[model samples]
Target: MIDSHAHLYYEKFDEDRDQVVLRAREAGVVRVINIGTDVATSEKSLELAKRYMGFYATVGLHPTTKVVDLLRDIALLETLAKANPDRVVGVGEIGLDYYWKDVAPAAQKESLAAQLDLARRLGLPVVYHCRDALEDLFAFLQQERIQPPGVFHCFSGGPSDAERALALGYHVSFAGNVTYPGAVNLQAALQVVPVEKLLLETDCPFLAPQPVRGKRNEPAHVGHTRDFIAKSKGIDPGELERITEATTVSLFGLS
Candidate 1:
């Protein structure tokens, strides 16, 4: 399994970073995409990628950093991507996040458009972040005809939203949230998305799965999320692994 998105470079794992990664591998996670939220994090992700064989990186400016120049940040990201084409698998952890009050909808829309353009230019799929703005996100993606294909990381939307995203050629990634007790709605949506378009992620240093809820999450916990989904869908864990692994590799061009 590939932890499609995680933030290992974050200080939360500073105490035992190496052990964290080792645990992930021991849990059967083959690769992890350490996503960057800004220029500094992007650089950190690149540095980590250079050192770890089981890790990859994606460069982009997240929506929350609204005041930053989209073109400039993306230009910098492009330079980073060009510097190491083989290591940078996708252009993302980028998109709208209105749930965070710091970013306005207009800025989020503009940033999303620019980043989508960058992904298209790089010929890479995107790893999107949508929060409290599905309709706006859908409109912009449709307007731009965004078709590079990607996944909605930690998707918190309903069945209709999942359908729209899949229709737009995106895989829907489920995170620890699906294991939450009141997340029946999200689980319902997850059921609707075909296994081929389903991906698994931990979004680590964040959304911890059941039995570890509210605690800081890490890549090793991805298996718990997968197990929950497998049980929910009445399938075996190995089948879920095969399906999610294939979906991730196809989406990110992973070997």
Candidate 2:
């Protein structure tokens, strides 16, 4: 299975990074895509990819980072994208987050636009981080600023939203939140997403699946999410694994 979204290089896994990776491998997670939220973390992700065999990286400036200097962020991400073409697969964890509207949506829009442009120029898929503000997010996406296809990570929208994203040539990725008992809306949305455009992720050290909720998530826990998605889609776990693995590899252009 391909864990398309993970933050394995974060300090949360510093204590037992090796053990965590081993557990994930033993759990049958064949590859882990480590994502970056900034230039520093992007470099760290590249370094980790070099050190690990079944690991890859996605470099971009997360909107929440408040990187208003769009040009600088784009320049840095472009440099990294060129420096490690093989290691870097996507441009992401990038998008607007109005959850904290107190920070003004302008900055988020600026950063998202710049990064989307960078992704188009680099010809890399995107890993979007859309939290709340679905209408605004959809508006920007509809504006046609980006060309390459991508996925919306931790999708919290409804069925219509999922359809819209797919129409826009974006895949919908489910984090552990989909397994929560009260997430009826999310479950319904998941049902509408086509299997071909579906991907599984842990968003680790963050959204641990049920039974492991409130705990530090890891790539190994992606199996739980895979099980959840399979059950939701009325397909077997093995089939879910096969489809998601293929979709992830196709999205990242990984062999």
Candidate 3:
């Protein structure tokens, strides 16, 4: 199994980060792609990837924060990607996040389009973040027609939204939230999406699965989400693991 999205560089794992990595390995998760929202975290993720064998990182600007200088930030991010080609496998965890007010929708669109262009030019996949802005996201994607289609990380939508993502040629990643009792809509969406396009993530230290809900989520708990998904979809756990892992590897060009 692989955690397609994580924030291990976050301070939540500061005290026992190594232990967390060990726990993930012990739980059978072989690779983890630590996503970056900004420049500093991107660097931190690359550093984390260097210390861990099966870990990797990505560099891109997130829209949740203010875009102080878009061009300058993209240039730095591009430099990071070029300087560490092997470590930086993709470009993102980048996209619109209307849930926060720090960056307005216009800025979010601008930043997302820039990063999307970056991924296109680099010939790398993208990891998108969409919250309360799926319509705008779908619209932008429809117009942009990106190459090497990316993922919709932590997807939170209905079957229609899943259809939209599928139509956009993007993988739909599920986090622990899908195990929630109130996630019937998400469950329905999951049913429609083919297993080949399905990816799983922890998105920790947040959205722990139902079994560990309200606690700090970690990669070790990814299996819980995986198990729930497999059972929900009537797929063998082992089969689901193998297929999703291959999908992740193919999408990110992971070793």
lDDT by residue for model 1 (94-177), tens: 888988899888887787788888899999888888889888888888877547788899998989999999888789999999
lDDT of 3 by residue, 62-96 (tens): 87967689999989889988888888999998888
Q: Which candidate is the best by TM-score?
A: 3
For model 1, give the 10-residue run with minimal summed lDDT. 65-74
lDDT sort, best first: 3, 2, 1
Error of 2 at 244 (Å): 0.9
**Which whole-number lDDT from 0 to 100 does residue 84 have in model 1?**
89
C-alpha positional error of residue 181 in candidate 3 after TM-score superposition, expressed in Å: 0.7
Best by lDDT: 3
lDDT of 1: 0.87
Cα deviation of 233 in candidate 1 (Å)?
1.5
- For residue 29, give model 3's deviation from the true position in Å: 0.9
Q: Can you tell me which runs of candidate 3 are displaced by over 4 Å?
A: none
Pairs clashing within candidate 2: none
Clashing pairs in 1: none
